[model samples]
Target: MRASLIQIAVDPDESVDSRRRRAAALVREQSGADLVVLPELWPTGAFAYDLFAAEAEPLVGGPTYEVMAEAAADAGVWLHAGSIVERGAGFDGPLYNTSLVFSPAGELTRTYRKIHRFGFDKGEAVMMAAGAELVTVPLPEATLGLATCYDLRFPELFRGLVDAGADVLVIPAGWPERRRAHWTLLARARAVENQSYVLAVGTAGTHADVRQAGHSIAVDPWGEVLAEAGSGEQVLTVDLDLTGLGVTREQFPALKDRVLGLAEPRR
Candidate 1:
């Protein structure tokens, strides 16, 4: 399956509407790709916590959703339109860092609200409500396990997706440049351990005084990096060999040997 990871550069000068239109155009450009993925919070820079409330849109029929749905239909591809700051319910209701997935027909297939909110006590942690459910989207080629930026650090979340029969992990992040190494390391680790394809897309350039880590990477089941972007806006496209995933798992069979429900370490 062919996939395109759009590493968008969230410029501070760009208006949210401009970025939304540009993102939709980019998605439309990937006409032949089976799947196209974008970075997290592309509308407003992820670290731009103050703008969250101003830019937050409804879960459905929002500007981002409307444009991206049309883009998916125009390109005839499955599009993971990254994430948006979702305003839940009525006035003063909770906000959510939500990821959206659209089918080729422009239908809203699945939505994954970011489970692991970023900031500990401030920023997103306090501003947004945590999502309780784990979401997986079933595609014609592969089943995708949805995760956001901070969620990548938690192995248990990925494991849960695997348990639910996810072979392709699609993580959209707005990771900072300071922790680029961890981003790459953790992405590879997730793919290697899960024996699945990892499509980790992140933002580029600077926003909210934080430079984004633009090394949007794709890792195969064997832990090999297939494609990676630089510290700028780029589209890293790769052809994923889904059939080889089963071969890698069959050869190593590490997943089958997992010992669950072990007793706590002798303390």
Candidate 2:
């Protein structure tokens, strides 16, 4: 299966509307790809916490959703349209860092609200409500486990997806440039541990004084890096051997040895 990961630059100078339009155009450009993925919070810079409320949109019929749905149909590809700051129902309702998936028919297939908020007590942690459910989307070629940004650091989340029969893990992030190494390391680790394909896409450039780590990457089931982007806006495209996932798992058979439901560790 062919996949295109668009590492978008989320600079402060670009207006949210302009970025949304640009993102849709980029998605439309990947006409022949089987799947196209974008970075997290590309519409209104992830770290731009102050702009979250101002740029927040509804889950359905929002500008980002409308534009990306059309782009998916135009490109005829299953598109992971990154994430948006979602304003839930009612004025006082919570906001969610939500990721959207659309099919080739321009239909909203699934939405994964980010489970792990970035900030500890401030920023996203306080601003957005955590998503309780784990989401997986089934495609003709592979089943995708959805995750976003900080969720990558938690191995248990990926393991849960694997338990639910996800073969490919798709992670959209807005990781800072300072911790770029961790981003790459963790992505490969998740793939290796789960014995599944991992596509981790992140933003580029700077916003809210934090520079984004743009090394969007694709890792195979055996922890091989197939493709990676640079520290700038780029579209990293790779052809994934969907069958290789099962082949590697069968050859290695490590995941089958996992010991689940262990007792709590002693203090």
Candidate 3:
């Protein structure tokens, strides 16, 4: 499939509507892409977590989502709208760092909340709810597992996604430039261990207090870097072989040789 990853610049100063417009234009320009993925919190800056509750929109009510859905429907391509500050019931809006997927037909197929929030040093991440489920949404072209930023740190989540028949892992992140090496290493590791394609998309530019290193990449199951982009506002495109993931798994059979099943507790 011809996939395009948008390494967008987080304009913390720009209104969400303005950024949405720019994103739509970028997608429209990538006419040949079958699927388009965006960076985490593209509408707003990740470090601007303080604005999340106020800037958040209901999953179904946001103009940001509507615009992307319309764009996907118009272009007849699938879209991973990356991460958005969404509002849920009771709390006014988006309760989690949620991502939404839209089909070519403009139908909302699946929604995945970030399973692991990146709260290692900063405690702001801990302010949000930890998503409990690993999304393995079935697309017409392939079955995709959805994850975001810090979730990349947890190999078990990707393993579970792969075990659940995921052919590709879609990860959107707002990774810092300080730990850029970790971003690349973790992404490649997931692809190697899971034996599936890993699409890691991150943002560039400063987000109020933090700045992200944009090195969006597409890694094959063999951990080969198919296509990579530097720290810039660019659309990194790559053609991925969905069948290769299946073929590799069949040829190696390593995934079947696992023995990490649950064990009885010692008495």
TM-score of each: 0.99, 0.98, 0.94
Q: Which 10 consecutive residues of model 2 have the lowest summed lDDT?
A: 252-261
Q: Specify the highest-lDDT model's number.
A: 1
The reply for model 2, stretches above 4 Å from the true place, is: 265-267
Clashing pairs in 3: 86-94, 87-93, 87-94, 88-93, 88-94
Local accuracy of candidate 1 as per-residue lDDT tens digits, 1-267: 999999999999999999999999999999989999999999999999989998999988999999999999999999999999999999887999999999999999999999999888989999999999999999999999999999999999999999899999999999999999999999999999999999999999887999999999999998899999999999988999888888888899999999988999998
lDDT measured at residue 197 in model 3 versus the true structure, 0 to 100:
92
Candidate with the larger TM-score of 1 and 2: 1
Candidate 1 colliding pairs: none
TM-score of candidate 3 versus the correct structure, residues matched by position: 0.94
Q: List the candidates ranked by lDDT, beginning with the highest.
A: 1, 2, 3
Model 2 residue 76 CA deviation in Å: 0.6
- Please count the clashing residue pairs in each candidate, in the order shown: 0, 0, 5
Writing each residue's lDDT as its tens digit, candidate 3 over 205-235 gives 8887787889999999999999888998888
Model 2 agreement with the true structure over 149-229: per-residue lDDT tens digits:
999999999999999999999999999999999999999999999999999999999979998989999999888999999
Q: What's the residue-level lDDT of 10 in candidate 3? A: 85
Q: Candidate 3: where is the Cα deviation over 4 Å?
A: 91-94, 120-124, 262-267
- Give the winner by TM-score: 1
